[model samples]
Target: MSQSSQFSLLSQRRFAPFFWTQFLGAFNDNLFKTALMVALTYDALSWTSLDPGLLNNLIPGLFILPYVVFSATAGQIADKVEKGRLARFVKLLEVAIMLVAGIGWMTHTLWLLIAAVVGMGVHSTLFGPVKYAYLPQHLKPEELVGGNGVVEMGTFVGILLGEVAGALLVSYRPVGIELVAGASLTMALIGLAASWRIPASPAPAPDLRINYNFVAESMRNLRFSAQNRTVFLSMLGNSWFWFYGALVLSQFPVYAKDYLHGDHSVFVLLLTVFSLGIGVGSLLCEKLSGRKVEIGLVPFGSIGLSLFGIDLYFASQAYTNTALVDAFALLATPGAARILVDLVLIGVFGGLFIVPLFALIQTRCDPQHVSRTIAGMNILNALFMVAAAGVAILLLGQGFSIPDMFLVTALLNAVVAVYIFSLVPEFLMRFLAWLLIHTIHRVATVDVERIPDAGPAVLVCNHVSYVDAIVIGAASPRPIRFVMDHRIFKMPLLGWIFRTAKAIPIAPAREDPFMMERAFIDIAQALHEGDLVCIFPEGKLTSTGDMNEFRGGIAKIVERSKVPVIPMALRGLWGSVFTRDPGNLFERSFSRGLRSKLALAVGMPVAPQEATPEYLYEQVRALRGEWK
Candidate 1:
């Protein structure tokens, strides 16, 4: 695989057919919905006599209602049914619904079209579990992030095109409605065609006896999801994003017309920029995350989401334009570009926030129950989106402006983010480690895959700097439990990171025998539970840029745990700020260039019987070479 391997997956049969199948599904869904929304918002009297605000919130609510009512059942169906067949069946349902919608469009019957909306919602509800659960089965663990990013990019791009198609097709003279109807039906047929090409995906739970009770199954699904604390909170975080998004996105039509003084075309422009931004951010996840499911991007994304969301409010306040204008004319206005940038950035950050969470959920959830877990999340998403609508109605009724809603959502995002991070400090810890490598040092790993993916193994690395654990942890695909000197846990900020990572803090035998004994027990337990534990055999940071004599402690660990030892080396990290730099703290901070070139080289795993201290020392030294 090349650096751009994510794009290359599109050429293979395993991923491409599914990609286009869902892409067209999204396109057709949005094509129908956006056309109806634009027509209703722009020319409401012709479509219905109802207030536009009620209709705006009501439409989305109707669409999301099925997720709450049917998602559990849908998840059960996805798990029990073969995926390719299910996908094709769902597409056929889409074709039938679009035909009904086409009829409603020609007749101008709002109720029929609204029913079609509910039907499409059912279609999506059925497909939701299949859409996500399918990826983990088809792609390698490393590919999940890139696969998800590509899918997300395709979904958003489809949405962008669909919204554009809806707006332009429905705004044309004489037969705009007919054009929308024809185009939606045609896309539905094309999506159905695409679905037929998808390869068979075996059901994970063919024997699962599905319950028909929505309330009961919904509870069961949530119970299964909540069984894992991190997965559960992640589900909530995922749902909260929808809440934030619904509040922000649902306001755009009105935000465009009433606040920005722009026409329906301007609404299209806003949606366009936002979707395009999400596409760019989604694609960037693979590159930014080093092609792994780095949840650190979650915090990074949350920060950007809140910042841009608040700025959007200010940007809207700064705009003084009062005359109605088209998209082109609005762009030429003084303050419009700022608003555009804010929307795009919000979308970009939104992509960063969401893709990793999805990947994490997939990787972390129970394999057999992936569909139900996703279904549970979908239910939560629906609930949050509904709550967003309620919040919008309540706030708007209380005289809050759309921009006020944006500000409130952004602030709430920060509060929720802090709460979630506090509950799971690993997200924050990983963020710090990821930040260190990406910012302080450029990290390259050689043969790093030799570190076991799924078994307990002892990783022995040279201790050259104070932040060696952080660098190694960030580089490993799976989590590592580090055994380090207990005193390092007393440092101010770094202490928090290590403690949050659940690093086993140890003391020298001569200093604190009790703590030393307890440390070995903890290491034994971690290994028995099948976790990767790394110990710096040098036992302390190097003072003279040379390896300390091999310590007996590693031999003791191997004897106790009886796991293979993987010797690793860190190169070019001796005189950095985090090391024993000769300069004072202030001077050491920047005297040498702060950023260092670092490489983590992993050798083949040594058998437990042969991983003696003296042998591993030579192995690590040979790997480190003269880079220091």
Candidate 2:
């Protein structure tokens, strides 16, 4: 059954407890971490003589170090142990760390607080695999995107509120340290209470031998994940976001204080808008993706990230304010809102870029080894984030302003995005198809989930327009290898996309028997390898905006492959620009206007024995109805 919204999950036992646990963990971690950061930045003499600027970068770097050192073992433990029990233990550790941090607050022991930071880092590292791997066990496949979206939204909201709470609490008069410490301990206990309610998730790999040598096991985890090309690239892509985010977020305090000459509240404002932007974008993923893991958003997001990031540099450079002020006073200054907008957009786009990738990684990686794969991604994130800190430190050392780092990172983001997309053309190809459906057409799918999520299946659909494949691809949860007529498949712009999508082009036997035979061989091969291959059994687009004669090719292919054939039909696309409408291109498109409503209705899967061309033709015709 399709879930109404990602928020529906919060009401269920399976999801709510897990959500609260994760939310609280993020809140506690950031609350303490940000409180420490604010104290150091605004009250530096009491903390240490270390450059507050340098400490800002170094602190985040310190927090991620445990991800490098402990992720392998953590992944193994998560894979081998019951997740609910482990979560409780992790939360218990948080409580202990908070106890230590409470002492740091009361005694004014900077070293103790710093150690608590590292301890909290260890807590997060252990929880990382459990957090992601837990969802796949609980949620349905269709719910993965929405589930992930809600989790991300909750996490960032937690981080945002925590940062805000921490910033506000630490700066309180008379007993600021006491307030911060008390709140941290209280949150840690609440998180532990939440953990007890999490439903039990059995280990996928109970026999996984725990490896104590973190370094060797970490390499093994990386090597294992590297075996899957797409998954590995996605891991790298996921890590790159962290690199970009760390670079941006780490600079906010200094940027607020030194550049904008603003008080701590100004720093809180930056964190507020940016995290809120991410929360909004993350929740939108479910709606934008039609509840599927739509990775096309990755490219779309990267474009915005670079555009706004570049603008952020210019926005800051344009600001002339130098008087020290709080957030409200800073808002009154010229050019400040632009900086806020840029940061918000950057966060929004970052959400768009990341949430789908997380869903993709979860859905794509080996089921029994999800934790380890996540560990591999975490390792990459740690390395990249550490690199972000090092690079920022180097830039600042070389006399680069905070805005200079923004410009450099923004430009580098563009380069990195292009490089990753080039390596995986699927990202770019899906983006084009997604753009078409979202901008020009609004698509609804009927009984589409009847198509199997895995294994071999033959998709036979009526060809209604030139973009039938693109439309179908846009609606599908999985990539479909479309088999198109050689002529239409070779059209200029469409041809480029077809090639990138690895669409197979076939000619009629009368024209080129060799190509026809080769196409069948390719179809059989794809099915044998367990892929979804969609073919237009109508053999050609209907000239009258109706179903064409059923070609015998579908029967022959089904007989050979012995796989279920899903009969589908496109409706309400007959007079669209790509169709054989009785009008010029401009006229046909103008008639359709924007966001034209179209539907792809899929019927029950026909067994190989029952899937004759005639039977399948009637099935598709029935599904399409007279909408065309």
Who wins the lDDT comparison? 2
Residue 177 error, candidate 1, Å: 0.6
- Assess every candidate by TM-score: 0.98, 0.98
What is the C-alpha local distance difference test score of candidate 2? 0.93
Scored by Cα lDDT, where does model 1 land? 0.91
| Model 1 residue pairs with clashes | none
TM-score of 2: 0.98
Candidate 2, 83: how far from true, in Å? 0.2
Q: All models: lDDT? A: 0.91, 0.93
What candidate 1 gets wrong by more than 4 Å, as runs, is 1-4, 583-588, 591-594
Question: On residues 1-628, what C-alpha lDDT tens digit does candidate 2 reach at each position?
Answer: 3358778899999999999999999999999999999999999998799999899999999999999999999999999999999999999999999999999999999999999989998999999999999999999999999999889989999999999999999999888999999999999999999999999999999988899999999999999998988899999999999999999999988898899998889999999999999998898888899989899999999999999999999998999987888999988899999999999999899999999999999998999999999988898999999999999999999999999999999999999999999988899989998999999999989988987889999999999898999999988889899998899765799998998888888999999999999999999999999999999988988888978879899888988999999999999999987888776888886878899999999999999999989999999999999899
Alpha-carbon deviation at 33 in model 2, angstroms: 1.0
